[model samples]
Target: MKAVIQRTANANVTVDNQKVGEIEEGLVVLLGVTHEDGLEDAEYLAKKITNLRIFEDDSGKMNRSLKDVDGSLLSISQFTLYGDTRKGRRPNFMQAAGPEAAEELYEQFNDFVRKENVPVETGKFGAMMDVQLTNNGPVTLILESRE
Candidate 1:
C-alpha cells in the first residue's frame, strides 16, 4: 500500500457534479493498493499516517500528529499511483491490485483510520472523482507500507 499525504485546510470530492466527500483542516490521503498489499499493510499505513507529526506546533514546528490537532482525513482510492511508465508512452497498471482486492483493502485502510478516532471522508471507489483542496503549507509527503 502507498499514500500521497497532503495537509489541507479544506478539501472536497465531487462525482458528476455531486459532492461525495469533504473535510476541513485535515490531510488528503491518496491511497493506492498494489498486488502485494494486504490487511497488515493497510493497518500499518493507517496507524502511521494518523500518528505522523506533520502538523505544526505552537512554535511553528512540524511536531503535532493528526490526532493531536483534532484533524480529519479525506481518503481517495488511487490505483494510478502504481502506474508503470518506464518503457511506454501509455502507462501500465500491472502493479495495481485487482478491483475487488483493492477495494477491500482500501475499505480496510479507512476502517483502520477511523478506529483511531479520526474522522475519515472518502470518495467513491473506482469512480471518476474531482477532488479539490486548499493545501496548507503545500506540505506533501509520500508513504509506503513496505517502505
Candidate 2:
C-alpha cells in the first residue's frame, strides 16, 4: 500500500460531471494497492496519515495532527502509483493489484480510517474521476507501507 497525502483547504471528486465526495480543511489521499498489500498495510498507513503532524498549532508551528485539527480525508484509489517506467518508453503496471483485490483493500483502508474517528470521503474505485483541491501550504508527502 502507498499514499500521496496532501494537506488541502478543500477538496472534491467528480465523476461524469457529478460530484461524489468533498471535504474542507483536510487531507486528500491518493491511495494505491499492490499485490502484497493486506490489512496490516492498511492499518499502518491509516495510523500514520491520521497522526501526521502537518497542521500548524497555536504558535504557528506545524505540530498538529489531522486528529488534532478535526480534519477530513478524501481517499482515492490509484493503481497507477505502481507504474514502473524504468524500462522502455511505456510504464508497466505489473506490481499493481488486480481490480477485485485492490478494491477490497481500498474499502478496508477507508473503513480503517473511519474507525480512527476522522471524517472520510472517497472517490469511486475504478472510475475516471476528477479531483480538485486547494492544497494548503502546498504540503505534500508520499508514504509507502513496504519501506
Candidate 3:
C-alpha cells in the first residue's frame, strides 16, 4: 500500500458533479494498492498516517500529530499510482492490485483509520471523481507500507 498525504485547510471530492466526501483541517490521501499488499500493510499505514508529526506546534515547529491537531482524512483509491511507464508510451498497470482485492484492502485501511478515532471521508472506489483542496503549508508526504 502507498499513500500520498497532503495537509489541507480543506478538501472535497465530487463525482458526477455531486459532492461525496469533504473535510476541513485534515489530510487528503491518495491511496494505492499493489498486488503484494495485505491486511498488515493497510494496518501499518493507518497507524503511521494518524501519528505522523507533520503538523506544526504553536512554536512553529513540525511537532504535532493528526491526533494533536484534531484533523480528518480524505481517502481516495488511486490505482494509477502504480502505473508503470518505464518502457512504453502507455502506462502499464500490471503492478496494481485487481479490483476486488484492492477494494477489500482499501476498505480495511479506512476501517483501521476510523479505529484510531479520527474522522474519515472517502471518494467512491473505482469512480471517476474530482478532488479539490487548499493545501495547508504545502505540507505533503508519501508513505508506503513496505518502506
Candidate 4:
C-alpha cells in the first residue's frame, strides 16, 4: 500500500459533476493498493499518517499530529500510484491490485483512519473523481508500507 498525503485547508471530491466527499483543515490522501497489500498494510498507513507530525505547533514548528490539530481526512483510491514508467512510453500498472481486492483494502484503510477519532470523507471507490484542495503549507509526503 502507498499513500500520497497532503495537508490541506479544504478538499472535496466530485463524481459525475456531483460532490461526493469533502473536508476542511485536514489531509488529502491519495491511496494506492498493490497485489501484496492486506489489512496490515492498511492499518499501518492509517496509524502512521494520523500520528505524523506535519502540522505546525504553537511555536510554528512541524510538531503537531493530525489529532493535535483537530483535522479531518479526505481519502481517495488511486491505483495510478503504482504506474511504472521505467519502460517504454506507456506506464505499466501490473503492480496495482485488481479492483475487487484494491477496493476492499481502500475501504479498510479509511475505516482504520476513522478509528483514530478523526473525521473521514472519501471518494467513490471505483469512480472517476475530480478532487479539489487548498494545500496548507504545500506539505506533502509519500508513504509506503513495504519500505
The model with the greatest lDDT is 1
lDDT scores for all predictions? Answer: 0.98, 0.96, 0.96, 0.96
Candidate 2, poorest ten consecutive residues by summed lDDT: 107-116
Model 3 ranges off by over 4 Å: none
lDDT score, candidate 1, position 74: 100
Candidate 1 lDDT over residue span 1-147, tens digit each:
999999999999999999999999999999999999999999999999999999999999999999999999999999999999999699999999999999999999999999999999999999999999999998999999996
lDDT of 2 by residue, 1-147 (tens): 989999999999999999999999999999999999999999899999999999999998999999999999999999999999999999999999999999999999999899999999999999999999999999999999997
* Cand. 3 TM to true fold: 0.98
Tens-digit lDDT string for candidate 3 (1-147): 989999999999999999999999989999999999999999999999999999999999999999789999999999999999999699999999999999999999999999999999999999999999999999999899996
Error of 2 at 111 (Å): 0.5
Candidate 4, RMSD to the unseen true structure: 0.6
Write down the RMSD of candidate 2 (Cα, Å). Answer: 0.6
lDDT of 4 by residue, 43-86 (tens): 99999999999999989999999988999999999999999999
TM-score for each predicted model, relative to the true structure: 0.99, 0.98, 0.98, 0.98
Worst 10 residues of 1 by lDDT: 138-147
- Candidates 1 and 4 compared by lDDT, better number: 1
Error of 2 at 125 (Å): 0.2
